[model samples]
Target: MLHYPAATPSDPVDASDDAPEAGLLPRYLARIGYKGPVAPTLDVLAALQAAHIAAIPFEAIDALTGAAIDIGADAVDAKLIGGRRGGYCFEQNGLFLRVLQAIGFEAEGLLGRVRWMLPDDAPPTPRTHMVVRVMLAGRPWLADVGFGAAVPPQPLAMDSEEAQPTRHESYRIVRHGDVWQVAALIEAEWRTLYRLDSVPPPAIDYELGNWYTSAHPDSHFRHQLIAARTTAEARYGLRDNRLTTRLVDGRSDRRYLTADEIERVLSEIFLLPVRPHWRPAIERAATAEIVG
Candidate 1:
């Protein structure tokens, strides 16, 4: 079993806040299409999170293509902001954490054990997923834009057990024993998303998790093609070749994509750069055993 570090609220684990230069803030804002006021207020944080999930998509193309995943600040900025590409949790949340710090929001990174689709009898998993906790107006809010398909568009008040409405789904945070579990309401059933620890692990743990998730041969990201993006009206998800679109009003549609359509949807819908060398991998993932 993995040992998680414990810390009090006052001594929460802090990730590196060395934001790229002053110009990075503007570039990131432009990349996410956020034109709202930049401040440390809750409203601004909510707007920024909403805009980010809509703009910068979630993807694991590099892992599929057998490339090293870099979670460094400069690499994240270049790929997510400068390059026309999407990334998985570490890159997405890592970048968002830095951006929030740049905007002077009291924010830090948190780790979670993903239990989204695992069975009840499944064994314990590692702390792989990354999230953000923001302190504003004397309270903490959970803001995560890197959870792919079911990511919450708006920040959720950490103290509330009420069903919080977001752009797409309803999310609630519940305490179980010493841990907190984030769940989403799906088709009238509540599904656990992940289990989070209040005290964040050291930054080195994030680096290690990224390496396992992106580079390890047994990692699911290496075998699957996963991508997701959400707009104001609906949330789009692609697992392998199957594409699913869930509207805000509770209607959903699913369809499998051809190899040619895969390229189109990845480029046009998810806004990911389809490089020339990635054709073989794309074709393989498109033709794999279909599972929606």
Candidate 2:
């Protein structure tokens, strides 16, 4: 696990009503299909988060294809906004943080260690997840759109341990000393999602984490096909060749696709433009392990 810098007295979170990067705000709003007010209120934040998840997909095609994942501002804008590609945590949350800041929200970047799908006795994982911390009227709320399969559809309150309802599932944040463990309710039981540290990380941490996740041989993203997107009615997640649609009423439908069908699904279901060179990697991923 990579050690992150400790939290200091510096305030990295900022709000600017007339942000110089405001030129990108219009295009971002259009990409998400959001036509709401651009204020820094809770309503705008929740709407933007939901809209983003619905419009943009969570994917790892670059990693699967052995391509270097760039987390810089210009690269992120070109790939996610200008191009028809989706990205993992660092790119997703990095773009989201910029959008929020451009809209005059007081937001900061956060780091987390993924505990999702890990066994109870499993060793601690690395800090690879990226999330956003937003302060609205002095109350802190967690905003994240990068978690592939079970992303929170709405912003979660950080100070509460009660079950917070979202579009698909209910999530809660439980404090463990200085760390906060986030959980999602599934099959009537709460399951661990990830453990987040409150300290705001430096920008360089994202570049390092992105490289490790996309380039490391041990990283599952390089070996599997992970894609996800949510809608008003259901959340769709694709692992390897199997696609699962989880509805809001607690019902789910799963289907396994053939290698030949991967491209169609990637384009039609996930809304990602299928590239010709990605076919080889897609074929390998279709035959890889089904469970991660």
Each model's TM-score? Answer: 0.91, 0.92
Candidate 1 Cα misplacement greater than 4 A, ranges: 1-20
Model 1 residue 31 distance off true place after TM-score fit, in angstroms: 0.6
144-237, model 1: which lDDT tens digit per residue?
9999999988888888888987757789998777677899998888898998988878989999989889988878899999999988899999
- Residue-wise lDDT of candidate 2 within 49-74, one digit each (tens)? 88899989999999988888889888
What is the lDDT, from 0 to 100, of the residue 36 in candidate 2? 63
Provide the clash count, candidate 2: 0
In model 2, which residue pairs have backbone atoms overlapping below 3 Å? none
Give the alpha-carbon lDDT of every model. Answer: 0.84, 0.85
